[model samples]
Target chain A: MRVLLVDDEEELVATLAERLEMRGITACWVTNHRAALEAVDRERFDIALLDVRLPEMNGLDLKRLIEAKQPTMKFIFLTGHGSEEDFNACSAESGREYYLIKPVQIDVLTAKLHEICAEQGDRQ
Target chain B: MNGSHGKVDTLGLDYFGRMTASISHEIKNGLAIINENAGLLGDLVALTDKGRPLDPARLETIAENIRRRVQHADDIVRRLNQFAHSVSGPVTTVTLREIVESTVALAHRIAAMKGIAFTFSQDDTIKVETIPFILQNMVWICLKNIFQRHDSDTNLTLDFAFQEIETDVVIVMNFSHEIDTAATKAAISEEGKPIILFLKAQIYNDQTNRTIQLRMPKKFID
Candidate 1:
């Protein structure tokens, strides 16, 4: 599946994209909201993985903006904050099944991504 | 300082929690990068075999990346430790430049998130005796107050100028726009009264010149 990774950490997002490509999944990454929007406008990405605590605009708000642009695109949030209050805030914005904490295991992340694709397949 | 005991308690707890959270978030971001880089190294080992040799250059690059992130995280932790020790004693003698620099270092991350930059004008630096924690908290609060009043401009900047007036040291926080007088007054008078009293400091809102001049005495006595 084609994926878009949005995170301010350049090395983290770039390395994740490289690894995803090695696993035969197409992934493109950007470091900010404006760049993320530009990438989406340029290409069709099935999934967008966003870091929740972005600099200018938080990832949840960016999710809304992207959803307006690409209604069919799905999202998965990545956050470094592990507090219950932070979790609740993010889950309240997106459903509970939609976020992964930082230092996330790649197997779990890819599993979730495939699960999302399968869910879409089921919907169709 | 009669009813201020409770205000101090509330403000201390509140500021302590927020500052810890912001700094910890920064540390976490650094850790996340290290995690991904290390995981990539393991991935490389798994993909290596007899026919296909592993690239030493790529491995070296990844190793270097991890080292850089470790140093980055170490620096953040050092800053956190510095902040924690700010309240180790009741009060201490410190330079005005040192106070501004330390507080700015702690706050620069939070400010950058909203695109705020602090410019310092240190013409003449003087020494003062004050509670380090309270003084830093006061400066941080004044920053928040300015942000609340003047964040309409997308490109926001706060300028800090230090001046000496006889026996007093005044650190003026200049703004990019003419701040709201009523809002600034209400915020300053109500929000940081405990801190103002604690540090024996006064916050004067110079709205005409778009500045908040924080005047503190050279000798602080409890």
Candidate 2:
């Protein structure tokens, strides 16, 4: 699946992208919202993995902007320090299935990606 | 001092939690990178055969990356420890520059998320006896207020000048955008105002010049 990764942590994003590639997934990553936006404009990504605390904009805000641009593009938020309150707030605003805390297991992430893709395919 | 003690305590706890969360997130990101690099190295090893030699250069690069992340995490933990210790003593003698620097470090992640650059200039050696925790909280509140009002590209300059004749230190925060008086007033109201009173510090906002000035006495007595 084609995926877009957005995070300010350059090393994390780069490494994650390489691992995803190793797993036979095509992943493109960027470190800021502007670059993420530009990447979305330039390519068709099936899903965008976004870091909640971003450089130019927070992940939730960026999700909204990207959704406006590509309504069908799916999103999964990554946060390193999300409290219960933050989780509840995000869930209340955007539902529960889209958020993931950091230090996420690659296998779990891959499983979620597959699940999201399957869900999208079913919807289509 | 008009706010309730419970409210002040809650605010301090909230600030502590927020800083801790941010710092932990930073450290977690560092660890995540190291983890990913290690995983990649494992993948490389698995792909190697008994007859073929593993690329030592690639292995060295991954190890170096892990080491760098470890050092980065250490720095973050050090800053977090310093921040936590600031509240240990109710009252202490602290240099204005030191507090500003510490507060800036504590607020660095928040500012970085908004793409705001903080420039601090304090050549004068000005020390004051006060509650460092409360002072730090005051500065953090002011920064949060400013960051919330301004855009990501905004640059903030904090300049410290000591008035020897008046025996006071003035901290001027200069930004590009015009100060939102209403929002600024709200930020300084309630819990924030009480802390300012507790610190015996006076705050002034110049809308025309887009500057916020904080004046503090050389000595604070409870």
State every prediction's TM-score relative to the real structure. Answer: 0.92, 0.89
lDDT for residue B206 in candidate 2, whole number 0-100: 75
Native-referenced Cα lDDT, model 2 = 0.79
lDDT of 1 by residue, B1-222 (tens): 235477876786677788888888888888888988998998888887535568999999999999999998899899888888775446688877778777788877778777788887756457788877778878778777766665633767778888778888888877775567557756976799987877778877766887778898888867
Question: Candidate 2 residues B64-182, lDDT tens each?
Answer: 99999999899999998878887655678878777777888888888877756666555547777778887888888888887777766655444444443377777667765555845
**Candidate 2, after superposition: displacement of residue B194 in Å?**
0.8
Q: So what's the TM-score on candidate 1?
A: 0.92
Off by over 4 Å in 2: A89-95, B1-7, B49-53, B122-124, B153-165, B176-178, B181-186, B189-191
Share of true Cα-Cα contacts across chains kept by each model? 0.74, 0.82
Error of 1 at B209 (Å): 3.3
lDDT by residue for model 1 over A53-108, one digit each (tens)?
88788898999999989988889999888788768877897788888898888888
Clashing pairs in 1: none
